[model samples]
Target: MDPARSSSPNPATLAPLDLHASWARSREFGLRPDDALSDALVSPADLRDRLEANARLLTFSRPVIENLFRQIGCPSSTLLLTDCDGLILSAIGDTGFLDRATRVALCPGAEWSEAAMGTNAIGTALTTRKAVAVEGSQHYLTRNRFLTCVATPIFSPTGGIAGILDISTDARANLSHADALLRTTAECIEHRLIENLGEGFLSLHFHTRPDLLGSPLEGLVLFDEAGRLLASNRAARALLQLHGEFPQGSYPECFTTQWRHLVAWAAFGPLTPFPLRTLHGQTCIARAELLLPRAPHGRRQAKSDEAPGRAEAPPAPDTDPRLGHAGTLVAEWHRNRCAGPLLLCGETGTGKRHLLYQHCRDHGIGMPLLELDGRSLAARAQAGRDELEDALRQTENGLLYLTDVDLLPAEARSRLFEAAGSSHRIVAASRHPLAREAEGNGLDQATLARHGAHIVTLPPLRERTDFAHLVHRFVREACPGRPIRVLPEAIDRLRRYPWPGNISELASRLRLMLALVGDDSTELRPDDIPDELLETAV
Candidate 1:
């Protein structure tokens, strides 16, 4: 519901009644419009107590507040987070802005509630329990008319206002974009607060589209061991049409998917998406994360692969020399851990996609991986459906991976760069380095310059030192439960061939060799190798 309509006003009604009410409240506080502003700060001891009381909010909100300030990039703008009472707990901005704001008591330790600060954005939002903007003369106090502020209340788990996130700037500054960003940022913070309540809760992350699974816009629902709804965020409430009654229902009342199936999926991992349908028939793609309590320390230690009671043998070591270096490059560009997009380049069958997945899994990067075939994206764009932009809206915290990016049409390439910008962490794969492709008129020069900041090139299979290891591993997987011994001469004969088709060709030939194996034969000989592979001997 819109805040302005909270008083049950008609859609066409309104002469700024919310503001008028705020003005009335200010007058009731005995604050004169022409009165001099107070520049006093709360005592140091009191400030310390407030900070300690809201430590969790600060821990989760600090990074978001800092990032918001960076995005504003205005020397006259300041970002602040305050408790429910409007006591400022954290403040960040340009040095010049901070100095100016401190004089108006807009810094940390100052109270900005409506009772003390008149009709200001932070104060008004808290009183109305909604997002609001107070600009220029809208402020009841004459002293505050020089500032423009937009604020939104952050809700706690129990459905009360936890705090307010506000952006204050010069009255002359335009805030058209700030309002939207502030709301989204507050939601992101609220989601984090709910996630922190993990013990004995089963958290469900879902959306109508699979590509949107890990994004901030995804609906989050928390359930207890008995499958009772314990808490939910704004997105969840809207998606489920809870109508203001949440945290009292059970899982069976909400979802048609059995509770046991959800538990089974959670025990495996949150990587795969399952079909989740509500009783109302809204189909959703969802992932479940089971947050069961940890076992005793000794029991937990025994479950580790390195523990003394390990039953299965450890896997063989990788012989690929390029994999480790590529992993470091990937970590450097991961959005949650670092910054920027990663451009992966390699020959066909050189395992570019494999490397991408391996690095993400090894590092425990849990964000959803939304892979888009560049050719398909371009095709859709030419058909007039702006698919790239649609995907961008659903990929706030996802890994957007584009495969065969070199195949994109010229117009689609431009659209990609413009639509993606810096709002997402994109990983694009191409058959060759983007710069080289640009020189051949297959890519945009500016696109190469932007995405080429960090590039990881994969070596062809023939050039890899791990050829033998990969062959053994692939063969083992291809013919499981029926082990075929590979002779030394057969291995040498295979290495003699120049593998222009790389790893993919090798696996194909191995599958064919396995097909020719007789029921009585356990050995793989050189004579069983395909004729074409031998004909291409170096």
Candidate 2:
């Protein structure tokens, strides 16, 4: 039997022993068959708050519920969703049966746990940590004899019970396969939850049936590069026989393959379905998705090729006044003539290129500065390998600066990496983080590790502590010979505003302010600020 199927109870047929045990537990809890159903345990306001708190869960599970309803929907039946604690978070039913559901407080805000209600499907499923079906006289409360319910717990990616999915109806309605439908729907919701939670982690898809690899029935697992399991869907957990808060150790501890072999399969044969065996010898076909590795923290030390007396030192705040400490660090790296490829990461218009120019000037380097647009280079490299070689030759013994390196095609990125390693020093700038760019451009992890060993991250203008100083400097630069004073109120407004466009935006705004003031005017006032700035000021 499949591990998933073996672990779960058959929803269509409840075992006699399990049913009797639940009844005994209900009786032990002081519940009586003659007791009337109680009102909702939580107030309306509290229910609303709970719903809002679980908004993300609801978003992930809603599609699964709707799909299940379309498959097994019946007149006079209702679908209810609840938190792990058994508080009803949502309820949707056939219009004809809605009023009946409300009379029993089977709607949102009601607590249906055995403590609050009785041995019903919702409560029993929570208590037993299994799918449950309860009907008619099986309910502990006498007033609940009119209904039947099938409920399954939805597990989180990390293996805890996140919530419950339940279908309830009039006791007389035939719910032949209600249990199976509930279990499948719960699996779908669990799969979506895992996918959402698995960002930045490698996702693995596997199934006994090859066709099911991309389907909802496939087992989904997430692991880090080090082979540490991060998360998995319910199907994956069941298939792998994993339990408790988290499965421990590396991938090989849980699965039959070594981590090195799995990494090789992911890198070299991602499209091929490889054989994966569980520790128990259950075999299946599996595929892996490898995400870009995170860039190593901190800059690498300068290479031996660095100029004499150009070793890195801590940058003083005044080196690049606007950049604060970040500018000082970049200046040190530039002065040191670090031979490794340089990566400048920041948002657009944050002066990445300007800093590069400043670095070249400070070092008194007179070699040719060869500028290459990554998109254009990618196109040339695609035409023929010789074109790429020609470009590299042109930049020989000079600084090769590639702008928007993130946009380079995969083929071009590989060629660039080879050329960068052999011919010239490369200074690349990107509007995205280097790791994200590598992923988008499909560059090899090893190439990025080798080429981008020395990385500098520039902070956006809004994050800089010297906002007032930058503004004054820009004003002086834009006005030239004229001394243009800025009103205190105008400066306050500038500081308060969030500059989405960064330093370039600040300079543009300053230029406009200078033009508005003209040579005759000496001071820029709050009124002189652009209407657009005023509208967006925060």
Candidate 3:
């Protein structure tokens, strides 16, 4: 037996407060108990608009509804999605409920607002902005009294009702579990809705239990680059003790953690959950999902004002100012150079390879950087063996950089371990911590323990505190030998734009800016910035 279907609410269990209010509102709409439901529906074109408007809701809800129907397996019930206005947008049901649904105009494009269907699930839930169940005889419309409908409102990222997810069944059928199911399904849809609110948003997921970090129960809060609280889901609002409306403020106003720290921690990905506490003294484990703004089109190709073949000076041993704590961490790694096998962990474009180059350059480790890819090694046995053996021998007095090490096959891993035990200085990199990958891949922990001891995580560009410094440095590099000044306004815009592509993306944009200028001694202004980048800023 399915746990979700284990219990049913008594027919009279729907609270009277909601019904009494709904009934009064229905009477006020001049809806008499005996009046028949009007044969009204949203027109085809209007329905299309509503469908497009609720596309995200539909996209995320369909799978959940299908799964719910399979779990319920009741021929007397139907599942529906409706816009905030109570117009049914989508519906699915069993053969037994199909005829009943059609007769009552409960199918797609049908209007079910309180004005049309009086004191019903979708309409009352919309009006009250709450979950509701209208059982037999509780419906204001005498025609609707033979059916039971439970509905929960799906809220938009901005906290307004986006749509409704409802389960409608024959009044005689027992569906006590429908209410819980609808709420849960609605939560899932709402969670995805907030998380995917595109570029330049930092989505933070948190829960009291570390294990619930990815589930619907987790609290989701979205912040703009300036750290303003853009939107939050139901769980977030509840977790933060937000009342009627989301308070107007920044992210730090609600949480104890600084915006920069959250951004940096999020770059490490979901494998690591950091502690986050609310201003109200509530603490939970949290992870951040960073969505950086992207260019609308391919990068502009233009010649720089500076001459070609300008050999840049090697970076000083101090650190890459763009990295902030990640830079410090890399510096620390270099300080303990040759301590053990090095593990560099972070999201892509986070400068894992860049750090390795810096480690050799700053520390003056003359060993050549020999590379072997784990995927290639895992894919071709003979070629990989030949490549690995060659790289190991060449880097015996140098360095061996192994990328995507988490993807290495067991055999490939054994060879690499043997090489690590040799004189070769080995550095392995992955998007996640090697230990976590070991557990996920069902690899032996003891094997990973040896190579994973010294791990350094590079923060994603969006999280780095030295964003402005990076912009200045890249801009200077782009227009080397020319007096180039980035206006404060342009710098502010660049800082607020989430650099999704990180260091490489930032450098590319700077080059584009110089290309666009096409002149010597240029002053970069806000207009010189990419329109896409500026548009994505808060």
Query: Per-residue lDDT tens digits of candidate 2, residues 209-259?
Result: 553565456888888877788888767777887767555455887788887
Clashes in candidate 3: how many? 3
lDDT of 1 at 471: 71
The top-ranked prediction according to lDDT is 1
RMSD of each: 10.2, 22.5, 17.2
State the displacement of the C-alpha of residue 251, model 3, in Å, after optimal TM-score superposition.
Answer: 1.1
- Residue-wise C-alpha lDDT for candidate 1, range 280-376, written one tens digit per residue: 7999988786553434431111122233332223236667768778877777666443345567888877777778877764665544456666755
Q: Arrange candidates by lDDT, highest first: which order?
A: 1, 3, 2
Whole-model Cα lDDT of every candidate shown, in order? 0.72, 0.69, 0.71
TM for every model, in the order presented, reads 0.66, 0.51, 0.55
Candidate 3 at residue 472, lDDT?
65
Q: Which regions of candidate 3 fall more than 4 Å away from where they truly are?
A: 1-14, 268-270, 294-538
TM-score winner: 1
Q: Tens-digit lDDT track for model 3 on 1-538? A: 5221222223356475877777767777777777766767778998899899878778667766776665555678899889889999988888778778888788999988887887899999999888988888787777777898889898887767899888899998887877766676788778767755664457788877553565565898878889988888888888888676444567878899888877765544433457899988999988775554433432222223344454233233343454556556666655654555677777766788777776654654433345565665767778777777766765554467887877777767667765663355677888764453446443444776765446677777777766666666766555545656667788777878766667766776676677777775468888887687667665
Candidate 1 regions exceeding 4 Å error are 1-16, 38-40, 245-247, 292-323, 331-341, 344-387, 390-414, 417-425, 429-538
* Model 2: colliding residue pairs: none
